[model samples]
Target: METQLRKGAHAVFNIQFHIIFVTKYRKSVINEAILSKLREVFSRVCEKRKCELVEFNGEDDHVHLLVDAHPDNNISQLISFLKSASSRIIRKEFEIYLKQFYWKKEDPSFWTDAYCIVSTGGAPLEVVKEYIKAQQKPKM
Candidate 1:
């Protein structure tokens, strides 16, 4: 989701949140359909959450998203929302195998608890876009 640039804002700030989050091994396996759906769901979440998903990239293990959000939204809240919602969507939609830690009758874990974040302070949009585009898959 791309944010509309309205002119003459009292405080027009472009806040970018670079999210580096991953799924557990053998869970949310890397597949074309899964990846595509993940991106789609993520975009929709941003749209509903009033955020702009500027850029995204990933391999099988991890994903990188560049999000430009408004000041009223809290960083941790958005991160938690994105990670938890996407994880649930993936597991239920794909019926992927779940590790014991992620297995449950009520809810499952699609993403690991660990996550990385980089808040861009007054950085240009292009700069953030380039970094997200250039995010490489973690070597393991």
Candidate 2:
């Protein structure tokens, strides 16, 4: 994975996150064509947020993303946008195929409301803890 720092006007940072999105009711609705479309949609969303979609892949019921994000971004908003936009686009593009999985014809949802997001990169937690512990104590 690339660990290069990104520069903003007044900040230099390297923040990455691993995110997971599951289909509504964990339905196995994703096929090769859907996966391809997902990758395209996710890439565009990441770019729109000024983030890099470092890695993206999925199985039938779920998808995973590794995003290198800017500090200025609000992760929650980014995720909301990702889910909503992707869901709308996917449902529109593959309505006929998705119908079997999602029976409700009106406003069918693609992804579940819940998601998993974890910060990544830099040293391990224990290593960081030890480094902090080793710092010189302030004079009494």
Candidate 3:
């Protein structure tokens, strides 16, 4: 994949993260339908935050995402938004299916409190450097 960079008035950055989110209590609540919805929700969240959802996939209880974002973006905040929005929507839309996993709780949380986030790179240093060099430098 080509490296995607974001430019600001004084900076340019290509920040990518591999994010993993597990369901509350690691219950196998996710199905093909949930996975599809999760992908859609994640893509929309990333777009709203000016990030790119490069890749998304998941298993029964957890999901993985590759996101490309700008330096100005706060990673944690982005994650919070994603989780909150997705959880709300999923719980609401799939209430019947999710009832089994959440019947005991008054308020059900779809995801666990902790998440995994790792930095990733799409291109090597030399290639990135060459691409940067090829860009028209800002007029001083």
The most accurate candidate by TM-score is 2
Model 3 clash pairs are: none
lDDT of 3: 0.90
Rank the candidate models, highest lDDT first.
2, 3, 1
Error of 3 at 71 (Å): 2.0
Per-residue alpha-carbon lDDT of candidate 3 for residues 1-140, written as tens digits (9 for 90 to 100): 67657787788887889999999999999999999999999999998998889999999999999998877678889999999999999999999999988875676679999999998887777898999899997899
Better of 2 and 3 by lDDT: 2
Q: Residue 78 lDDT in model 3?
A: 92
Ranking by TM-score: 2, 3, 1
Per lDDT, the best of the predicted structures is 2
Task: In angstroms, give how far residue 18 of model 1 lies from its true place.
Answer: 1.2
How big is the positional error of residue 2 in model 1, measured in Å on the Cα after superposition? 17
RMSD of 2: 1.8
lDDT of 1 by residue, 37-117 (tens): 878888888887778788987887788899878766788888888888888887777774444336565657677788899
Question: Model 1 TM-score?
Answer: 0.71
lDDT by residue for model 2 (50-80), tens: 9999999999999999999989899999999
